[model samples]
Target: MSTAGPDCPQKWCTGGACDGARLDSLLTEEARWLWEQLAARADRSGEPSMTGGTAVITAPAASTQRAAVLGLLGSRPLAPGERRRIRLEELTLRLRQHGERLTPGAVAAHAAGRALGSTAAERARQIARTTGLRKLRARLAGALPKNARLRPSEEAWQELHRTGRVARVLQHPQPEQLLKTAAEVLRLLPPQGRVDRRLLAFKAAGDPHGLDAGTDLAGLVLAEAAAAGLTTSGMPPRTAWGALGVDLDRLGGGLLSLGVHPDGWLVPARFPLPLPPATLADVSWPAPPHEAPGCS
Candidate 1:
C-alpha cells in the first residue's frame, strides 16, 4: 500500500500517512457484508433495518465542530451503492513512516496533555479521531441487513452486477421501520445507557465491533421494554436462555450479566457463581431471570 503522498485519495491525510488506508480497505468488504447480515437478522425479528450509505469522517477540537459534521452525516444519509462517509481525525498520529520528527505515541501524549473537563469527553474525542467518521460509516454500511426485497428487476441486477459495488438485494420495509423505532427508543435513554445497551446488544448478537447493526433486535425490544417499565433491572440473562427453555445453573458457569437501566446505567453481575468464565452449562438460577420464546 502506498503511503499518503501525491497518490493518496484521503483529503484530511497529512504527512503522507497511508498505513490506515490498507487496513481501511481490507476491512471494508467484510464490514459491508456483516452489516447486511445484521440488518437481515433484525428484519427477521421485526426490528429496524440498519441503513447503508456514504459517511463523512472528521475530528475537530471542539464538540461544536464534531456536532456540525455529525449533523451533516444525519442529513446526507448514505444510500446503497454509495461510498462510505468522509472521515476526520483530530489526533496527530502519523499515518506513514516518518523520518523521526514525532513518534505515534507522542501525538497521543500531546492530546492527553491538553486536559479536559471530563475524561469521558476526552476519551470520546480520542476514539472519534482514531476511527474517524469513515470507519464508522463503513461499519454501519457493512453491518446493515441484506435486503432481499429490493433486488433489482432481474435485468437490473444483471446490468449492475458488474458495476455495482454492493450486493443488490431487496429488503422489507419493516426492518427499516423497526430500526427507526429503535433509534427513537435509543434517544429516550441517557447517552451512557444508550451506549452500553447498544454495545451489549451488539455483543449479544455477536457483532465484532460491539456496534449494533440490528443483529440482536432483542436489545431494541429490551430498550423499549425498559422505557415501558417492562424490565426495570435490565433484561435478565436468563431471559435469553429461558426463551430457549434452558436453565442457567444447569448449563454451568461461564456467563455473566450486564444489566442496563433506562437511565443509562449498568449493573453487572457475575453469573452462576458470581464469577468470571461462567457459561450457559453452569447457570441454573432457580426462577430463570426472564422469559424466552419457548419457556413453557
Candidate 2:
C-alpha cells in the first residue's frame, strides 16, 4: 500500500486569507462609525474663504511697512466681509517684541503650531478621562469588600453602568478583571508581615517577571506595599528587597561619601566662638533624631 499524506485542506492552505478579510471588514465598519459620529458633530456655520475683505493700512508708506501688511494679509484667508484695518508699524513692533518675524511664512507656521497644540491637548484630555475612570472603578471595587455595608446608590450605579457600556464600545477591558487580579495579589501578603517579592510574584501571577522593574504590575505592587507601610522611601533597594525577603544578586547598594570633597578641599570651616541661639538653630545643634531644629 502506498503511504502518502492526504491533500491539505483548502481552508488551511489559504494561509490567513480568510482572517485578513474578516479583520479588514471589521476595521472598515469601525472607521465608518467613527466618521459618521465626527460628521454629525462638525461645525457647519460658514463657508471657508481666502481674504474675506479688503485690508486698509494706516501706517507710513515704507517698503518694510508694505511688506508687513501684505504678509499679514496673505498669512491666512479672511472670513466673509471681515475687513481688517491694521497699523503696519505697530504690528511689526509687536511681532519683534514676541521674537517673531513679520512675514507670511512665520505667521503660517505659528498658526500650524497652534492647531497641532490644540489637537494634542484634546488627545491628552481624552486619555486623562479614560485613565481616571479606570482608576476610580478599581478603587471603588477594592474598597467594596472591606466596606460591605457601604453600597453605591442606585443612581450612581446606573450612571457607572452607562459609562462602562460606552467604555466597552471603545474596547477597554472590564474593571472586574483588574479588581480580581489586584485581590489575588493582595492576598499573597500577610496581615501583619511581608513576603518575598519574587515568591509572591510566582504565587500570585505564576510568572517570575510579573513584578520585574519597569513593569506595570511591579509599580502597582510597590505602590500598594508603600501605602500599607510595608516599604519606606528611606530603604535602599537591597534593604527594601530584604525587608520583603527577596534575594537579589549583583545589585549594588547606595553610595556613601567619606572624607572626600568633589572640589578637593578637606579643611574644616572655622566658626567664631559664642554663637547665638539663632545660629545654633541654623546649624541644627542638639536636635533630636528625625526632628528638625527650632521645633519643640
Candidate 3:
C-alpha cells in the first residue's frame, strides 16, 4: 500500500553517483583514446614517452577519471606549504555537505592507477609512510603545543584523505578554462591552419602532460611538426597550470603540453600547423569503416 522511497541521508543528491559515474566514464574513454593516438604517432618516431618508459602508465578509464578528481583535491603549485590547508578546505567543504560518499583513499587509488602508474604508486606509499595520515596527525599534535588537550577532528581525517584525491584530479584535463582556451585555439587554427607554435607556449598553464589530453595533444602537435619538417630535437620541456575554479586560490589545476616529433635530428621546411580538429579520433569503441581492415 504505501509507496515511498527511503531517505538518502545525503544532504543533496544533484547529479551525484549516477551523474558522476557517467561523466567519469565519458572522460576516461576520451582521455585514453587521446593517449593512444599520441602513442601511435610517438611509436613511429621511436621516442615514445608513455609506451617505452617503465614509469609510463596505462590505467583503466575509470581509474583515469578518479585520478583527475584526486588532482583537484590534492597539493597545488600555488600553495607551497598549504597541503594540509587545502585538504582541510576541500574535505571540510565536502563533509559539511550532507550525505557525501566520496573518500580520499578511493580517489587516490583511482588516480594512482591512472596518472602516476608505477612511479606515482611508489611516491604515494612514501607519502603515506613519511607524511600521510599518521604524519599529519603527529604534526597537528605538535602544532597545538600550547593547547595541552587538543584532539584531531573527524574533519582532519577527511582532510588527510583529500590530499590523494587532489593529486589524482590534477593529473586529468585540468580546469574548464584550459578547455575553453583550447576551443579558442581550435577556432583560430581551423583545419589545415598554421600558426607559430610559440604562440601556444604560454597559452596553457604548463606542459601538455599536465593538460587532460597532454599526451594526445603533444603527440598530435609533434606529428604535425614532423609533417611540416620541423625539428623538435632541441626544445626545452615546458609546464603549465589549469587554474581550475573561478577563484583560482587552490591548486585543483595541473595540465601539461609539449610539441611532439617523429625522430631526432630532423629539420623543418615550413611553418608549424595544427592537425585538423575533424580528424579527432574516439577510442571508446572499435575502429569504424575508415580504420577497419581492407577499407579505404
Candidate 4:
C-alpha cells in the first residue's frame, strides 16, 4: 500500500500513513454537521401541535413519533445552512437546562463528550478568567464609599494586597489606584439630588457598566448614602440606588402606589362641584390590629 503525499487530498487514500491529522479534522467537521442537522430536525418535530386546544399526540404517542422522525431524518433532504441557527438555539436550551456555568470549552465538551485540545481549552480559560475579573471589579465598585475624601488606611491596603484570591483575579491591582477612582466617583455624586447611573459611571470610570447594580463601587456609594440618613427602606433596587443619588435607569422615577384601600375613595385633584365644609370633617382612620398606629 502507498502512503498519501503532502499534496494529496487524502479523499481516496486509505493506507496506514494517509494523514491521520487531516482525517481527524474532516471527521470532526462531518460529526458536527450531522449533529446540527439531527438537533434541528428534533427541535422542529418536538414542538407541540395543537388542534382545538388539544395535543395531537399523548406522551407515549409523542415518544413513538419522535423515534419515527429520528429514523426518517437519514432519508430526508435538508436546506443549506438551515440547521445552523436551530443548532445554536438547541444548544442554548440544553445549556440552560443543565444549570451550570457556561463556557466555550464546556459547551464544546458537552457536545463532543470529551475535552477540547490545549489551544481551544486555553482560549476558554482566558475568556472565563476575563469574565471573573470584570465581576470582581464590579463588586469592588459597588462597595465603594460616597465620601471622596475618605481614604483606606495603609494597613487596609496591605491586607487587601496580601489576600491570595484578590491577587489572582486582579491584574496589577493597586490600592492607591482603587482609592483614586473611588474618590473621583464620590466627587460626582450630588449632596442632595440623584444623578443618572450611566452618567455617573462614565464620569467616574469612563464606562457606563462600571458601577452597575451588584458592583462593589455602587454598594459602597449606597452604604455612604444610608449613613448620610437617606431613606431607602421598602424601595425597589432602582429606587434604592436613586435615593443614594444614582438613577439606575430612565424609568421608575415616580412614586409606586400598591393600590387603593377597599374602603377608600379616589379624590379628584380638581373637583367640578364645591363640597360642604362638613364633608371634609377630620375622621380618624382605623389602624390594623397587628401594629401601633402612627401619623404619616
Candidate 5:
C-alpha cells in the first residue's frame, strides 16, 4: 500500500511541507475558484485574508474632514459613528470615481483656532473656513455625469439597491413634495432659459451649507428639468440626475413604466404643455420675487 517516494518524507507526508508542490495540482476546481475570490478581495482591499478575522477599511482624513465639515453645517446633531464611517467610504468612492485624490487633514491650528506655521495657518483657514459650500461643489464638479435627468426618489432609491449587498436608500422624496418640486423648477425658468441649475437646486433643497454633489436632492433638481424636456446641452444626464437630487443607476426602467423616456420626457405621448411667460398676476407663480433682504 506504500506508493510514496521522492516527494514523500520518510513514509508519510505531514502538514503542508511535503505536499506543498502538489497542492495546486491537488485542488478541486471549486476550491481554486474560492481561493481566487479570496485573493481578489485581498488584492482590492490591500490586505491579505486571515483565519477568522475581518478587514476594516479605515476612513481617510479627507473623507472624515468632508463629513465633519458637512456635519458642522447640518447633519443629525451628530450622526452615529458607524453611519459617519460608511459615509466616509461612500465619499471616497465617489471622489475616486471622478478622477481626483483627496488626502485627509485640516489645518491642526485652524481646527483648534490658532496660528501656526507661516503658511499652514493660512492654508487651514482657506480649506477649513467653510463659510459656504462653494469648495465642496467644486470638488464634485468633475465627477458629475455629462447627461443627467431626474426621476421619482422612490424609483431612484430602488434602482440603487438592485444588486449591491450593502444597499442604501438615501433621501426618499415624497410623491406630493416632488410634484411640487417639479413645479418649482418650472416656475424658476428664466425667459432666456438656462438657470445655474446646481445653485438653484441648492437653494430649493434648502441646504445652504452646500449641495453635496452626489447626494439625492442635488441630482433630483436637475432631473426635474430633464423630465420637463428643458435640459440644455452640456452636463451628463447622470450628473444632472444626481445634482437634481437622485442617483438611481437605472432610472430608465422606472421611466419606461410610467410611459416616460429614460430621460424623463414622455415618448409618443401628451402634446407639449404650454410654457408661456409668467404674468404679474401669477404672484405665486414666482416663489420669492426677490432674495432675502440682505442676501447680496
Candidate 6:
C-alpha cells in the first residue's frame, strides 16, 4: 500500500501504491517505439550517448545506490595513507569554515568505528542547523573527512560513495554535453502543447539504447509541467514517482531535475539523460488508430 519508494521512503506517499505500476506499464509500451526511433538515428550518426553504453547495473541488495553504481563502473581505490590525507583536508576545511578543530587521531580512529565523533557529529549538527545550499555545503564538508579511508563506516562510506559517484559522473557529459543531450530530448517537445506521456516516446524520434522511453518521456513532462507550474494537486492519475523513485534518486536531482514526482512526468531541471527498448518490445501493445489519436 506504500506509495513511497525504498529511496524516498514515505514522503509524498498517500499510504498506498497508488498509480505507480500502471504508469510503468504505460511507459514500457512507449519504450518499444522509442527504440525503433533510435535504431533509425543510430543507422545515421553512429548512435550518441543517449542510446550507447549499458545503464543496467547489478549490485547487492544491501548496497547503497552510489555503491551499486560504483560497484558496476568500478572505482579507483585510494591507499589508507591517501585516504588519511583526504581526511586531513576535511579537517582543515572544518577549521577554516567552522573554527572547529578536531584532532587527527580522533578522526582517524573514528573513521573505522561508529561515526559518533566530531566530524559526523558536526555534520549532523550543521545539516540540522542550516538550510538549502548552506546545509549542502556543510554536508559536503562533513563528507570529505570520511573519504579519507576506504572501508565502510556506513555513515562515512555512504557519503564518500556519493562523492565518488559524482566524480565518476563528472567524467562524462563534459561541461555542456549533458545539457545538450537534454536539449535533444527536449527538442522532441512541441515547445507549447502537452504531449501525452505515451505518444511522446514513439514520436520523439529518439530511442537511444541506454535511455529508456519512460524516463525520456518523464523528463519532457517535467519540463512542460515546470513551465506550466503543474503541482501534485493537479496531477493526473498514476504519477511517475511511485514507479521510478529509487532509480531517479540514484541519478540525483542536479543532473536530472525530476521534481518530487518520479520519472513519469513534469519537465526539465538540469542536464543529461536509459534502458534497452528491445527488451520490452516483445510484450508492448500500442493503441490503434482512433484509440489514441495523438500518437503518429
- Per-residue alpha-carbon lDDT of candidate 4 for residues 63-134, written as tens digits (9 for 90 to 100): 333333232133343433333122333333333333322222232333344333434445566567656644
Per-residue lDDT of 148-242 in model 1, one digit per residue for the tens?
A: 11111223223322432112111223434444433433332332211233334343444332323233344434432333333443447545323
The best candidate by lDDT is 4
Lowest summed lDDT across 10 adjacent residues in model 5 is found at 102-111
Candidate 6: stretches off by over 4 Å: 1-107, 110-179, 191-205, 208-220, 227-234, 237-296
Compute the lDDT of residue 142 as modeled in candidate 5.
Answer: 29
Model 2 stretches with alpha carbons more than 4 Å out = 1-67, 70-123, 126-183, 227-230, 241-296
Best by TM-score: 2
- Residues 191-260 of candidate 5 have per-residue lDDT tens digits of 3434444555555655432234455444444443443444532577655533444333331222112222
Error of 3 at 82 (Å): 52
Better of 3 and 5 by lDDT: 5
Model 3, range 35-121, lDDT digits (tens) per residue? 343333333333312212222223334544334434434443222222222333354234223223332222222322322133455
Error of 1 at 106 (Å): 33
lDDT on C-alpha atoms for all candidate structures: 0.32, 0.39, 0.32, 0.42, 0.33, 0.30
Write down the TM-score for model 4.
Answer: 0.27
lDDT score, candidate 5, position 50 = 21
- Listed in order, each prediction's TM-score against the native is 0.16, 0.33, 0.16, 0.27, 0.20, 0.20
lDDT for model 5: 0.33
Per-model RMSD to reference = 24.8, 21.5, 30.3, 18.4, 25.1, 31.0
Clashes of each: 61, 1, 41, 18, 30, 17
Ranking by lDDT: 4, 2, 5, 1, 3, 6
